[model samples]
Target chain A: MDDEQQEKQHLANDGRQMTLIDQIIRNKVFNCRYWKEDCFGLTAVTLVDKACKLDCVGATYSGTGKPVPFLCLLMKLLQINPDKEIIIEFLKSKDYKYISALAMFYIRLTSKPKEAYPTIEQFYADFRKIRIRNLDGTFAIWHMDELAEKLLSEEIIFGISLPRFQKRWILEELGQLEPRKSVLEEELQNQEQEQVQVAEQQNQEKDQEQGQEQ
Target chain B: SDDGKQKLNDEDTLDETEYALWKIRELKRIKQFNDEKNKYEIEKAEIDRRRNLTDMQRIQEDFKLGSDKTKMEDKTKYV
Candidate 1:
């Protein structure tokens, strides 16, 4: 119960606990019903319960510009400033895509370039279909992989500005990061090798026919 | 027609700010990509131009690429 009095500090980004969400929207989130009711008294440890229950990922809706439960939970996670281990656990959660999505959003907001890229990049393999709540408050199907790629490549998503990170290629060129090998690279290489063998066999057959003609 | 235009304008001004931000970031990312690629191409051309340079000149050229002095020294050993 002592941890429940949790300081009302904002999320830290780039060495400052600044409002990562726009001030107007953050205020709207605070005033939203979901934020007041469900988001109350959530500590870093207890936030997972709410995170697991999230069904859709979105920021604010269009007409009224109302914050969704997903965004409210996101704000709560930001407020609590959970440990790296806890956030990693959320990212690793197998049963809930929303938990992982929430973690990705958290990472994109709080982490430095060195930490954020690899943390989100690994999830590019998660192709499970997930729902994204559009600005119009409509749910649309989005793949887990697309979200990961967007987190890495796009500077903004769901109406939040992700802290800029050095591009992966630049890091690789500077010898600071390794080139990412795609999961499909091995299969593509095998297909090319098989094609080469078939072409070589065809060439041999053509040569044998020419020799017999001579 | 004016009333319809007014409603359309209001709608665009509402949640379209986020979309506008996305578009700006997308354009900026594309520009950065082009700049990085062009820089790479230019560096490759320089390396190719110095294909017949002596070992000492090659080391100097690598240093001019603005990498760390320590890394340049280490690379000099292998060159």
Candidate 2:
């Protein structure tokens, strides 16, 4: 809730129509300290232009495992709705493997197997050298060539689960990933539903008694 | 002094009106706060529903490839 965050909140409150992903990025990305850099002062307005200039060098937020700003850029790309060929062109590039991986993540999530798989297939060899995160909790680099192969093959790999990668975290944070709800949540939902039912039944019973009296 | 007295006389009737205006303003403030609190709670609950991690845990389930939560739960118990 600093001044910059407040500004983004104002921008969001301005009643501009955005896609769900844009809204998600708008709310969450500025909170990460990664974009707090002198160069990367971001808003929904400048988010796309600044993100296009992003490189792998000095792109990470060291205090946490999540790279919130960079992922916000990736989400911006997805929100823009470019052609499949344009994204395929991105995957073929040699530089900015982190952004490339994000493109891959987006494709794998959004596209059909018939479309996404073949496009990602040839790039597996190229992506082999791209390291995203390690096997442990730390953000120390792990070569993500295997991850690319799995994604191309449509396998789920565990990510570091940080507040960085604001899209994934927000998706998981918003409980859109129905597969991951904890047991406690299910229990609470059930309990609340039952309580509502019981309250409704009691109201009906009271109404019946009042009718009989009348 | 006559003008000042006239102003004071003008102000004397305004206090009752002022009291009602202040009450309306306070009511609006309370309604605004309640609305914001309700919105905050709903948004927070939505986030909580989607979150898989707690502040104390570091290990995460690899929820990729349509894996079962029970099996992932067994594996992620380390964190």
Best by DockQ: 1
Give model 2's share of reference contacts: 0.00
Give fnat for candidates 1, 2 and onward, in order. 0.00, 0.00
Instruction: Write candidate 1's Cα lDDT for A1-214 as tens digits.
Output: 2222232322223323337777777788878888888888888777878877776778988787889788888877777677789989889988887899999888888887777878887775555657677777666666666788788888888777777888777777788776665555586689999999999999999999999999
Tens-digit per-residue lDDT, B1-79, candidate 2: 1232233221122255554553454444345535755686798887785585763342243344346466766876755
Off by over 4 Å in 1: A1-15, B1-79
Q: Give the whole-model CA lDDT for all candidates, comma-separated.
A: 0.72, 0.47
The CA lDDT at A40 in model 2 is: 49
Looking at candidate 2 chain A, the ten consecutive residues that score lowest on lDDT are A160-169
Once fitted onto the true fold, the runs of candidate 2 whose alpha carbons sit more than 4 angstroms away are: A1-27, A33-67, A134-137, A153-214, B1-79
What is the C-alpha DockQ of each candidate? 0.03, 0.01
Clashes of each: 0, 4
**Tens digits of per-residue lDDT for model 2 on A1-214?**
5534554564577622223233434444555554455224344345434645553311233345344445556544544445667666666655445556666666765665445545554443331233233323223322334454455433334431211222223333466432223223465588899999999999999999999999
